[model samples]
Structures are given as C-alpha cells and as structure tokens.
Target: MNWLNKLERKFGRFAIHNLTMYLIGGYVIGYGIYYLMPNLLNWLTLEPGMILHGQVWRIVSWVLIPPSGNILTIIIMMMLYYSLGNALERTWGAFRYNVYIFSGILFTVIGAFILYFITGGFIGLGIFFSTYYINMSIFLAFAASYPDMELLLYFILPIKIKWMALVYAVMILYTMVRGNIAVRVAIVASLLNFVIFFFSSRNMKPYSPKERARKTKFKQQSRPHMTYPGGARHRCAVCGRTELDDPTLEFRFCSKCNGNYEYCQDHLFTHQHVK
Candidate 1:
C-alpha cells in the first residue's frame, strides 16, 4: 500500500478525475459495439492467448465489454454504479479511487494470464474476463462506507444498504462454492481491492458523511496546533506522533493530500489520503 503513496507522489497529477463517468462512457461505447458490431467485441476480450500472439489491444479493450444484460437492466446498473463510484471518489479522492479501479482491472488481467498459463492456453476463454465484478465492487464499497444509507428496491421498497451488502456477500460465497475455476479467479481478483481498501479506509466506521465534513473542518482549523511533542516541525497526520516521540522515524509530506500533511515512516504509505 505504501507503493500507492509513492505512486501518488510520482504520478497523482495524471490520475483521472470523475473516473466513474469515463468507465460509464466506456460501457456506452461497449453497448454501441455490442449492438452494431457484435463480432468485433470478441476481438476485444481479455484473451491472454491472443495477447501472447500479439493482439495486445485486448488488455485495454476488454474493459469496454459491458456486463451482459437487457437494455433496461444495463441502464439501471450503470446509473446505480455511477452514483456509487462518485460517492467513493468523493470520499477516497480521485487519486485513490483511480488506484482502486485501475487496480481491479489490473488484477483481472493478471488473473486471466494466470489462468491461461495454468491451462496451457487450452481454454481460449477470453469471454470469461469482464468488468462485471469490478462494477460489483463499487456497490460493496459504497455499502461498507454508508451502511445505514437506504436505497429503493425496485424503486418502491426501502431497504438499508448494509442488508443489500450482506445479500451480496452470501451470493458471492455461493458462487465461490458452486462455480468453476474461472468464476473463482474473477471474483477474487476483481474484489481484492474491496478487501484491501475497505478495511484500510480512514477508520471511518462510526462517522457519517456530515460528521466527516465537520471533522475535516476541525482538522483544518487545528493546523497550527499540529506541531506538538517538543515542538517538532513534522508530525504524522495519522498517529500525531512527531520526531520527539521516536527519533528513528523518518517523516515525509504527502503530495497527494490537499494541504501540508506530513506522515511518519510507519504511516507514510498506509494513511488514508486527505483531499
């Protein structure tokens, strides 16, 4: 995860903003491709065999393959995930959200390759890899972050998000138990980001969005008081520990955070990014 901190510092400027919209846009194009030139989509799947044979475009183009569904279902799915993705981006900030999304895509690609090699390229299963589970992860993350939030089932019945998440967990568990190897790999790879980022996120279990806003404001107001523990110039934003607390701790400022946020060596890579 520290790799993310280093990466943010080095390439955070290039991170996509409102990344969810772009993914939705990709899905729109995919739907167009699906309806207009269905055969071409086969060429765009994440086929490691074809990739090894020099059709490297499959690595990126696979994302354009929208999840299989009727038009109405697809539209509703897109709308729901777009809202969830934006919520995550707002809370995690664009850089971390970009990392989360891109990481899921990356992991899926890697899983495809691993499967290909394990099966010795006999499967020729390009169609197996898609962004379906990646999109599902957005829902899981939103549920974790806003457990108490309610959504309308069928746009009629009100239900809490956490219950929906629990349902999802049961479904995923069932799939893992009953599905074949490809399903298992896809599920694990795609949802790995949820497992990692959800747990590591900001220690935010107790606070609501409004409470977080208040706390953020309080943090900004308390900036001057940050230099503590024998007036050390650098104090970790996460632990509030300074040079005086531990002489061995090296400190650095996060270029990705909105302000002059410094972190000690232990937390420099792991802290929740401040926007």
Candidate 2:
C-alpha cells in the first residue's frame, strides 16, 4: 500500500479520468467487430500460443472480445459495469481505480500465459479470459465500499449490495468447482485485484462524504484546547492565530515536530517542523 501511494504520487496525473467510458466503448467496438467479421476475434483473443507464432497483437487485442453475443445482455452489462466503475473511481480516486483495473488485466494476461505453459501451448484460453470477471471485480469493490446501498433486483425486489456480492461469491465458487482449469484460472486472475485490495485495506474504512464530514466535525470538537501564556487556546504555531481570532480555524498537533506544536489545516503539511 505504501508502494501504491508512492506510485500514485509519481504517476497520478497519467491516470485516465472517467475510464469507464473507454471500457464501454471497447465493448461497443467489439460488438461491431463481432457482427461484421466474426472470424477476426480468433486473431484478437489472448492466445499466448499464437503470440509465439508471430501474432503478438493478440496480447492487447484480446480486450476487444465482447463478453456476450446477446444485444440486451451486453447493454445491461455495460450499464451495470459503467455505474460500478464510476462509483469506484469517485470513491478511490482515478489512480487507485486505474491500478485496480489495469492490475486485473495484467493478472489475466499472466494467467493466460501460465496456462499455456502448463498445458504445453496446446490450449487457447481466449474465450475464458474475457472482461466478465474484471467487471465482477468492480462490483465486488463497490459492494465492499457501499454495503448498505440498495438496488432493485430485476426492477422489483430491493436488495443490498452486500447480498449481491455474496451471491456472486457463491457463483464464483461454483464456477471454480465445475469449470475447467482455464475457466478457474480466468476467474481467479481477473478477481485477484479485488482479493489483494480487500486484504491490503482491511484496517482502513471506506466512508461516504457525509460520514467523513461528520467524523471530521466530531474530531475537531473533541480536540483538547491548548492554553497559552495569554490564556489563548486552540492556536496555530505557524500562523499565530487562536480560536478566539477565528473560531472556524481547525488546529492539529504535528507528529513530526520535536515539541507540541499545533497547525491549522492550511499550514499543517507546508509549515516547517520544530527541531
């Protein structure tokens, strides 16, 4: 997680904002390609065996494979994934969201190659390694972040996200049991990011904006007031402003400073530390 933070600080600007649009667009283009030239998908799928035989483009082109052939199914899939992806982006920021998605893709690619090697390059896992599980990962993350959020199941019964996630979990387990080696690999690889993120962030709580604001307000109110020589309390050491001067100014003690020095939010990260 520290490494992720470092990477975000260095490459956050390069993250694609609103990445869900591109994913949906890819599916649209894939569907068009599927309808026009169905055989072309054979060359575009993730076939490591074929890649060794001079079709290297298959590595990236595999993403062009539509998850389903049914029009209605694809439409619903796109809409559901788009909403989940957008919500995750807003919750985790663009960089982390990019990492989650890109990592899933990377893992899927790795799994394909591993399967190819294990099976002696005889098996082609293109069909198994679709964006279906990647999209499922997004839903799992959204459910974890907003467990209490409800949605209409088939536009009739209201259900919580946690319940949906649980159902998906059972489905994945069923697939792993009944599916072939390639199918199991695909499912695990695509959802690996979700597993990694859930464990890595076990200590951290995902809070909604309102809940975050409430927590901040509570902390501010409960902070012990520091008394100064002139009977001043809640003062910023750098700005030399007390709560009496500006009642709205929040103060926090700097852990890096040698002594007990407080700073306002504006100067908390920018002010020089005491020796």
TM-score of 2: 0.78
Score residue 104 of candidate 1 by CA lDDT.
94
lDDT of each: 0.86, 0.85
Instruction: Supply the global lDDT for candidate 1.
Output: 0.86
For residues 1-275, could you state the per-residue lDDT of candidate 1 as single tens digits?
Answer: 56667888999899899999999999899989999999999889899888988999999999999887788998899899989999888876788889889989999999998888888885567767788889888898888778899999999999999999999999999999998898898899889888888676555532446666787998888767665657787788889888887889899989999987889989999998998
* Model 2 lowest lDDT segment of ten: 202-211
- Which lDDT tens digits does candidate 2 get at residues 107-201? 99999999998888775567788888898999998998889999999889999989999999999999999999989989989999999998766
Which residue runs does candidate 1 get wrong by more than 4 Å? 1-3, 200-211, 219-275
User: Residue 206's C-alpha lDDT in candidate 2?
Assistant: 40
